[model samples]
Target: MEIRVLGIGCARCNELEKRVKDALAELGIAANVEHVTDLKEIAALGVLMTPGLVIDGKVASQGKVPSKDELKKLLGGGK
Candidate 1:
């Protein structure tokens, strides 16, 4: 699975990436996680806010960080 964290390298953006990594580690699911810092790319993804979470190329969450539990529910168990 591919997960993209869109942000301009702010603290919240970094924290979101950490949370995503933690979630992946907890779930034991291997995914390609990328941090998007380019304004053009972020805008192309239709994210007007930082800390946007994109799973499998589709926008999952925007404007805020999601909890690890919430991430598990969103990503599911065992891939």
Candidate 2:
């Protein structure tokens, strides 16, 4: 799967990346995780806020870092 974490190298952005990795590890899923730091790219993805989470090219969450449990859901484990 393809996952993108959009941010401008902020703490929250880094934390979100870590959470994404942790969630992926817990779920035993291998994904190509990328960190998007370009403003243009992030905007093109339609994320208006930092710490955006994009799963398989679709916007999943934005503006704040989500908990690992929440990430598990976002990663397709739950509703």
TM-score of each: 0.93, 0.94
The root-mean-square deviation over C-alpha atoms between each candidate and the true structure, in angstroms, is 1.6, 1.9
Give the winner by TM-score. 2
Q: Write the per-residue lDDT of candidate 1 for residues 29-50, one digit (tens) a residue.
A: 8999999998998999999988
Q: Cα lDDT of model 1 overall?
A: 0.88
C-alpha lDDT (0 to 100) for residue 22 of candidate 1:
94
Please provide, for model 2 over 26-71, each residue's C-alpha lDDT reduced to its tens digit, 9 standing for 90 to 100.
8999898999999999999889999999998789999999999999
In model 2, pairs of residues that clash are none
Q: Tally clashes: model 2.
A: 0
**Residue-level lDDT for 7 in candidate 1:** 93
lDDT of each: 0.88, 0.91
Candidate 1: stretches off by over 4 Å: 77-79
Q: By how many angstroms RMSD does model 2 differ from the true structure?
A: 1.9
